[model samples]
Target: MHSAGDPAPPPPGGVLWSLAGDIRGLLMLPAALTLQVAHPAVGAGVDDHSVFRTDPWGRGERSLRSLQLWVYGGEAAAEEGRRLRKLHRTIRGTDTRGRRYHALTPANYAWVHATGFPVYQHASRYLVRPLTRAQERALYREWLQVGRVLGLRDEDMPPTIEDFWPYYRTMLADEVEATTVVRELLAVDAPVPPPDRGPLTLRVALRAAWPLLLPPLARFRRFITVGLMPPDAREAIGLDWTPRQERRLRRFGAVVRVIVPLLPERLRYLPRARAARAAWRAGRGRQG
Candidate 1:
């Protein structure tokens, strides 16, 4: 567990704070997860151990909650980190290549964490404004701080944005693939149930409409999943992106950029983020 001496979570109003909490940030998550499981070891671990196929909504909700905690949960962030490590203790298996893998193997674990940086960088270009060089560097530094909160040592990730790209490119070229999990995640025909959360009325409506909804939903999933991925990473993983798809994505991104900023805080940010921002403001008011 992180002590007082350990690095604090990303401070309020930083690049990570601004992005990670925004509702638009959700658009980037699938791309990051796609990049993650494109690694054979990560793919193997998820295919064998994750409930993603059987319970996609639950798995996604849980993953989202954990991600929110890493940035907005403050002291709870380190505890969440410890919880994740313990959870993955038994998640070991063999990849399609017949090599054994463990979820927490430093390189494997680090790669999963590392995917977020590039995905965030790429997605920001389309969903939000493209980050300035200073903002990009600050985002990387804050990401590293979150990594520390997740119990990653400084050596596990490249030290700076300058060092990170080469490492990312090397992993894309040498380690990533269209593994079983990646294919399933991208597959339009994969059976996924309607979300079971939300009000009873909403849940019932979703269940009734799911059959009709699934096709378009799945296609949209594939679109954003492919479109948001870094071009080099997409090519490395052999996912196709056509010129028409690029134009469509740009149109979609333009709409999102126009709309998202117009939303109020309650509408624009997730629950955890809303609460954290409120608490931080309250604390600052008291200090003043």
Candidate 2:
């Protein structure tokens, strides 16, 4: 139906997920196509690092981690996303220090809001290593506090989830132990490249963060940001998308969520200062 000069466009798997008979799905795709990024582990971790699933559960701008869950299908499908719906139901928090939501403390929330230091985020009470019986008791108390904060019952905890398994609740060492885990997974194992003595810092970061800052362009920023940003800051804000792209993105994210649980377990425990202490001894040995 065309002349020699007119070349045919690529086919969408030969009309399966295709519509309108064009092949610009890649370019014409909407921005709200969120893609869920999961971790090496699965299960409850699915909701862990999720944005909008943040602490003080019903608090300020800070919420769960939702970087890749904006939409799931084409133009029509983009309308009924259930991200926030699932988010609110899963996260848990309450004012322990006082009735005021910020009574969890304005200072602590500020700490997490600005730098995401983890101490102020959910599950922080038990992040340290219990050195003695007393420390273990204190850690247990903190664990209880964390459970209260997350709205998790004793039955919902790591130890009892898939049945009382000891593998989930590993022994703790010290506060530094949790921090060390952070150092290992992100900063240590993936050291930041020395700043290019370039002319622009914002531009460089923008270049690096462009994928997150402007995800449609690249995914490098998203990968780089994994476990680096606070759960809240790592949200799933995006532009209006088409139904098809939404469905496609969601299906893709769902697959990843299945594989990685959409969130990392380490992030959940670390904010509450969860420590994987074996790394500490390993680290010391390396240095020694």
- Report the number of the highest-lDDT candidate: 1
Q: Give the TM-score of candidate 2.
A: 0.22
Model 1 ranges off by over 4 Å: none
Candidate 1 is scored at a TM of 0.97
Question: Residue 194 of candidate 1: its Cα lDDT?
Answer: 94
Predictions in order: lDDT = 0.93, 0.26
Model 1 over residues 88-193: C-alpha lDDT tens digits?
9999989888999999899999999999999999999999989999999999999999999888999999999999999999998899999988999999998999
Best by TM-score: 1
Error of 1 at 26 (Å): 0.9
TM-score of each: 0.97, 0.22
Residue 104 CA error for candidate 1 (Å)? 0.8
Q: List the residue pairs that clash in candidate 1.
A: none
Model 2, total clashes:
35
How well is each residue in 1-288 modelled by candidate 2, as lDDT tens digits? Answer: 223432222111221111111111211111101111111111112224333223222321122122111111222121212333344443333222222222113222211211211211211221111135453333333433333233333444433222212321221110001122222222213323323343697657756864444333224323323322222323321112345644554455345335433345453222211222234346668999
Q: How many residue pairs clash in all the candidates, one count each?
A: 0, 35
